[model samples]
Target: MAETMIDVPGYKAGTWVLDPSHSEVTFSVRHMMISKVRGSFGVKSATIVAPENPLEARVEATVDASSIDTNDEGRDTHLRSADFFDVETYPTIEFRSTATRVEAGDLFVDGDLTMHGVTKPVSFELELGGFGVDPWGNYKAGATATTVVNREDFGLTWNAALETGGVLVGKDITITLDLQGSLEQS
Candidate 1:
């Protein structure tokens, strides 16, 4: 099957740096098999390299593992420990695109996601939020992408079993990207 291609006007070929103040990387996982726990990672750096052919575009992003915030200090500490991220050993989570394509007006990116020292292939569906000039007169573009992954696959397997049933934490984690970036060049 052939993949669709999009010519996003104003999303011209160049390097786009993700604006940390305007962008977010978040994740949610089932807690106690009944509730959900959410958290966000502070992005250390991110860049999108769009080529003359948009399908050839590439994405590179890094998140500060130690900056994970879930609003609870105690839980945050555990998340940074060996039980979860082991931030001291693996300081950052990174993603690098392997392929990019357009389908149904949305961009599909296949990439290698590295977390907890494990690397795996993952895919994200990105919806373009459009491009425009920001208040600071910088040309900007926004997009949102999401994907679900298993924590265990990344070596983040620490968990407790509930006596009643199920487990303390679920395996599946939903990751979301609310990305906004400024064009370095047109």
Candidate 2:
């Protein structure tokens, strides 16, 4: 059990390696000002250094930029070009926690998110999924976090004006993360 200000049961203190196979980084943005386009990036790697006080934990993660999948090959390719991610120039998206605290009874992690070679402070509202022991005896923990960012703020300003009204893509993007990690016993 965690002795932190927040109520997280079975929270173990140790270094945890992300279970990339079971974790995901997904996002959605309004398309054509009517529908939404959802996509996901494969997790390159993530690690959590949890202390007895969960609020003191440090999280570091990297997401593969070229792994973006939006169900459209052309758009994905475009996203990898100079107009967007430009994987050739910026191959990875990274996040490093700067602070963590309980706000209004909810856990929030403040971090620096680097994408498209731009770094900006972002906050993630975290929801603990509790901890458990898998059948193979590995101690595990999971959580879901989300935050919204303006694409233009990160320099992803590629969009075409629609003949009817708004632009082709929305500026605000919603990013959600479902992460599971295994505690590495020393």
Taking every candidate in turn, the Cα RMSD to the unseen true structure, in Å, is 1.4, 2.4
TM-score of every prediction relative to native: 0.95, 0.96
- Residues 49-126, model 1: lDDT tens digits: 988887888999999999999999999999999999999999999999999976665678999999999999999998
Tens-digit lDDT string for candidate 2 (1-186): 422555477988899999998899999999999999999999999999988887899999999999999999999999999999999999999999998988667789999999999999999999889889999999999999999999899999999999998999999999999999999989
- As for model 1, its CA RMSD to the true structure in angstroms is 1.4
Model 1 residue 171 lDDT score = 99
Query: lDDT values of the candidates?
Result: 0.92, 0.94
| Clashing pairs counted in every model | 0, 0
Model 2 poorest ten-residue lDDT run: 1-10
Full-model lDDT, candidate 2:
0.94
Best candidate, TM-score: 2
Give per-residue lDDT, candidate 1, residue 155: 92
| Candidate 2 segments exceeding 4 Å error | 1-4
Which residue window of length 10 is worst by lDDT in model 1? 1-10
